[model samples]
Target: MTHIRNIYCIGLNYVKHAAEMGNRVPEEPLIFSKPTHSFVKTDGNPIELPADKGEIHFETEIVLYIDKKPDPEFKVEDVVGKIALGIDFTLREVQTKLKQNGQPWLRAKGFKNAAVVTDFWDYPGTDICRNTEFSLVKNNETVQQGKAENMIFDFHELIKECDENFGLDQGDLIFTGTPEGVGKTEDGDEFILIWDGKEKGRFVTNLK
Candidate 1:
C-alpha cells in the first residue's frame, strides 16, 4: 500500500488562521500528526463525518511529501520529496472543548479520512516561495486561497523546524496549516484543490 510511513503537521502556519482561531501566532511552530493510513487519495472514499462532533470544519492546506530517509542531520531543502494540496478535517466543536479542558486534540483532529490529499508536483526548493497561487473551490466557487509568500514559517523554514522537532522519515507527509477561510462542510460539498492555476484533485464530503 503506497502510504505515508509517518505524518507531521504544522498548526497555524498562517497568521490569519491563528487570529481567526483565537490563538496567537506562536514564537515556534506548533506541530501535530495523523496516521499515515488516514491519507485519502483520488480513489480514496468520500469523507465520513462523526455523528456527535459538532461543527466539522474543513481546513484546506498545503501538503509536503518527504523525499529522503529519516535524518536528523539533513538540510531543509532536501526534506520534501514533492508538494501537494490537502484538506485537514477537524471536529471543531470537539477541539474547542478539548482546549477548554486543557486536553490533547488528537481525537478531534485525527480520525478516519482525516487527511485528504490531492495530486502532487515536484516543486523545486528554490522556486516554491514564488508560487503562482493555490486555491480550494467548494461547489465551484473559490473558498480558500493560499500562497507560500503568506506562510508565517514559509517552506524551507517550516521543514527545518519540523525536522528539528520530529526527525522526518521517508514516506512521511507534512500538512502545512490552512489559511483563513475555514468553515463547516455540508453534505454534497465538493472541494477541488487547484495548484498553480490547474485542478489537482477533489474530495467530496457526506453529511452525518
Candidate 2:
C-alpha cells in the first residue's frame, strides 16, 4: 500500500467563500489539515457518498505538490514544484453544525476520499499566482466559479503559512481552497474540476 503524508487545506481563501460561510470578511486565511488518507483521486473512480452525513458538497480547488523541503524562510520561488487542480469534497451540513457547536472541522471535512487531487504538473507560471479561473460542474450543470485573484489570501502568503507550520517536503500536497457557489452532490452525480481552460479531472459518486 502507498503511504500517506500530511493533508493541508486552506479555508475561506476566497472572499466569496468567506461570505457564504457567514463571515463578514476574512481577516486572514483559514487553514486546516487532514490525514493523507483523506485524498481521493477523481479519475473515473466511484466515490461513496456518506449517507449519514447530510449534504455533501463539492469544492473545486487548485492543489499544490511541493517538490522540496522548505526552510522557515522559504520563498514561493524557492519552493519550485508541481501543481495539480482538484476538488475538495466537503460535508457542508456537518461542517455548519460543527461550527455552530464550536467543534473542530475534522470529522466533517476529513473523511476518507474527502480530498481529490490530480496528476501533478510543474507550476504553470507566475501568472497562476495572480488570477486563474477555477470552476466545477455537476451533471453538466455549472455549480461553482471563482478566480484565484478573488482569494483573500494569495498563493505566496498561503505557501508561507503552510511552510511555517507544516514544513512541506517533496510530495507534500496542499489544497489552496474552494470558491463560492458550493452545493450538494448526490449519487450518480457526475462532476468535473476545471482550471483555467483545461479540464483537470472528473468523478461520480456511488449510491450508498
Candidate 1 clashing pairs? none
Question: In model 1, how many backbone clashes occur?
Answer: 0
Model 2 lowest lDDT segment of ten: 1-10
Across residues 44-138, which tens digit of lDDT does each residue of candidate 1 receive? 45677665667888888888888875465665467776777888988888889999999988888888878888767775674654465888999
lDDT of 2 at 31: 85
Steric clashes per prediction? 0, 0
Evaluated against the true structure, the overall lDDT of model 1 is 0.79
TM-score for every candidate vs. truth? Answer: 0.91, 0.91
